[model samples]
Target: MRNINLVLMLLCTTLPVALSLIDGLVPNGDFEEGPKPSQMNGSEVVDPHSIPHWELSGFVEYIKSGQTQGDMILPVPKGHFALRLGNEASIKTKLQVAKGQFYSLSFGIARTCAQQERLNLSITPDIEGKGWGMLPMQTMYSTEGWDSFSWGFFAANNEVELVFYHPQAEEDEACGPIIDVVALKSLSLPKTTTDLLKNGNFEEGPYIFPDTNWGTLVPSNIENDHSPLMGWMVESLKAVRYIDSDHFVVPEGKRAVELVAGRESVIAQIVKTVPGKTYDLEFYVGDAKNLCEGSMLIEVFASNSTFYVPYESKAQGGSKLVLLRFKAANDRTRIRFLSSYYHRKSDFSGSLCGPVVDDVKLVSSILHA
Candidate 1:
């Protein structure tokens, strides 16, 4: 009596494959995309008869013929995880569910650059640290294309997470977030299974407060010396490549952030304390026309041992994505990336070329999840 049906697909790599299929992994090795088994006639994808509630980690890579937004090309967790990145396509997957059963989350995206593709669609709340919080479960956008779009969320938490906000435009083409579908099914509590994660009824698009997401998801740098926190892109306490020049060479043990180039690097870093409690040291600041233009707001004082944050130079590149609410005796101190607290104390200038920080995520000033 556990027919937990799950259908994961994004087909069209040109095949004759078919079915409610399930099971696929290899998230990313970059093998062309989808449709294999000698090239066509099905060599895979076809194992679903409803029996998986949810379980898909990340990267399985596949996008043959290219229509799907590749990432777990086949890791079947049908209980739900659609998010093809609609503004879609850069690759993202996150989950942490576990409740009394009944899961169904959804968010089908589509983007070509609907006016700069602000594709900045955000709504966070899968937070799990403040007295039972699960207040976000809303999203469904896809007007039609490849006719790929589907949404259906109703979770009580076996777990939950699906954050994919895209805005790395310069010519764009992470291609086809064109999700074909997203699934999740588990319902059998005629009396106690009705909260389907209640209060998550949909409709709350626009709360980017996660430090503005820094230039959104960058590339095309101009340089304020770099620091939309560069997603905490660190290195150089000893140096070798961690030599972190311009700070956007990402690849040191991943928490994940990709957007590189040279000429304006520094990008902040520091989080080795938790004394007297006063945390909320957010990060963000972007600008670029060829090298800085506008935006840079700083505030990191752990006893006034250091401070710096001045970014201004713009034709395009945005994010002060700021958020600093402090009160501390010491969190172990340190949060810097040059600007050197105006070095001389305050005449700090501009054009250091920065802007590009991805999910440096740290919300525990008092614990929200």
Candidate 2:
């Protein structure tokens, strides 16, 4: 009788304490979490200390357990740390709490390609591209060391694949470096979670241009990742439908826009944009053919008059990525793609043409409420 009484007293004493502990772990005030492990990524990644507690899911290849350089590392100084990769691939993870909200994303990343390869990264549209956007990888991660590449975008959907790509492949000495991690961080800012999406919007594209075919084209059918197979051209279109078999590419010397013309089709919504805010933009222009010249123009702040913004040099010569940032108004802002821009001053004619967009990000540190 005494023993039974003691057991009952102990249970009664610990119940309230246990409940209090669980209450602290519930997300959004939902169900609580039980006990958790002390740490995650026990041995798979490098400098295990850099990575905190995360449940990682990855597609690893050519990974040797004993190799540290070929694994995922963590928390590079805001913008200081950099490493070199040698024929490897991997991605770290974070439990996305704001699963359906759009976030302003920025990170410094690059790869060392001995020849014509590039670094790559990819992601699945969880909730249909809902919370983030990225550019197709093409920057040459030269054999000399590494390069810096970045992009920005609004998440168009959910349940999507997330991937990374590394440039250069052919002349890789023994093995080409996949990519070196710089930093992956989400800036802190206020954004409308509800106002960003419309009718389950999506980034449905892989619109391969038949103009240049150095390799097989992988459409959205491939997992949302930077697969090696996507070596050729890749494009992303919001709220779109793609057909790979009949995809069109502009022919050499016969220049024309692969315009998905019509207002509703070409324009992308500026989700959660405040009336007065500044943002940066970038896209590519390049030789998609042997002797063809192509480029693009971005239309912004146009009050019915198609605004013409052209690509300027920062990297590759004529057709390359151009970046511009400006204050945006609270009202609806229109964005469009213009095929050609004519210089009336000298009668100079040039058009922006490139396989894919690199960075279309909007970011600001000082924001007004």
Candidate 3:
């Protein structure tokens, strides 16, 4: 009875802390809390630690909703405040994370002045030297003027500092990207099942902001090892949008990935296979039903088989299943998927859209025999 009571007490205290890490945003991540008047020199933050719960350096500006730079009004993705990182500017916050665990950092970003802007993100105490990533802002996928992006990292220590830095030294100090709603979510290592591929259901991924309709974009060339979308490598020059069924049509389950950049957006995985063994790779190709209308084509590459699946999206939610049977020629086989054409919403939102790939499964042919 004493041991059981002690165990109950421990669970009662630790359970909330674990749940809070998964559900709650980082302290003032949305930047809804503003700095005092003394911290301001016009729009530029005068004090490095003026902002609550955040440390800043270089030319960081505290921006409010409806604030204008010239004739352009800066839009905040959520809440009334956002932070702008100017030339070589950066904002950082410390997090208490479980050591050796994987976490995904999701944040909203919008370009203000520079057309070729990009954000440098890193988590320090990086033992493996793979804790940093660069996300390009050259393309705007949503017409909402801002998009949320996610990057995954392995925690090297119990406490880590998450930093977002703008590396550009533009002529205008204020010319940079606006950021808001920074969130961190713990990711479980996807388990391999009867399916040859891990995370084949596209169920595990970065956190999605509930208030925003646009899904999180996983940056290009993300490796399978540290990808925000677990077990899949984004192997193209352009990022792939991770959509949720809450805001967009998902072919199956609650989540899926949209290949929005045509051939430029690709997701792939490598699976161990027995030589001369036959396997069947299956997936669903569909539209997100977010006003994306057209003939969408998805190309699937597996071992020694290549297949093209065409989907005619009438802007209504629907999906078609595709299968590719192949014989494994090596001990390992590479499986990849890419859209053959790019598309935008028919609503003239200029928002990039494409076929969603989900419910992917790969199994040995003998399993069906």
Q: Pick the candidate with the highest TM-score.
A: 3
Please provide TM-scores, in order, for all candidate models, with all chains considered together: 0.25, 0.32, 0.93
- If both were scored by TM-score, which would come out higher, candidate 1 or candidate 3? 3
Error of 1 at 54 (Å): 13
After superposition, the stretches of candidate 3 with alpha carbons farther than 4 Å from their true spots are: 1-20, 127-129, 222-225
Candidate number achieving the greatest lDDT relative to the actual structure? 3
Ranking by TM-score: 3, 2, 1
Each model's number of backbone clashes?
Answer: 52, 56, 0
Q: Model 3: clashing residue pairs?
A: none
For all candidates in order, the CA lDDT equals 0.29, 0.31, 0.87
User: What ranking of all candidate models by lDDT puts the best one first?
Assistant: 3, 2, 1
Residue-wise C-alpha lDDT for candidate 1, range 100-170, written one tens digit per residue: 32222222233332333433321123222221111111211111221111112233343345433443434
Candidate 3 C-alpha lDDT tens digits along 15-104: 644653674478899998888988899989989998888999999998999999889999898999999999999999888777787888
Q: Cα deviation of 117 in candidate 1 (Å)?
A: 3.9
Q: Residue 152 deviation, candidate 1, in Å? A: 19
Better model by lDDT, 2 or 3? 3
After the best TM-score superposition of candidate 1, give how far the Cα of residue 56 lies from its true spot, in angstroms.
Answer: 20
| Pick by TM-score: 2 or 3, better one | 3
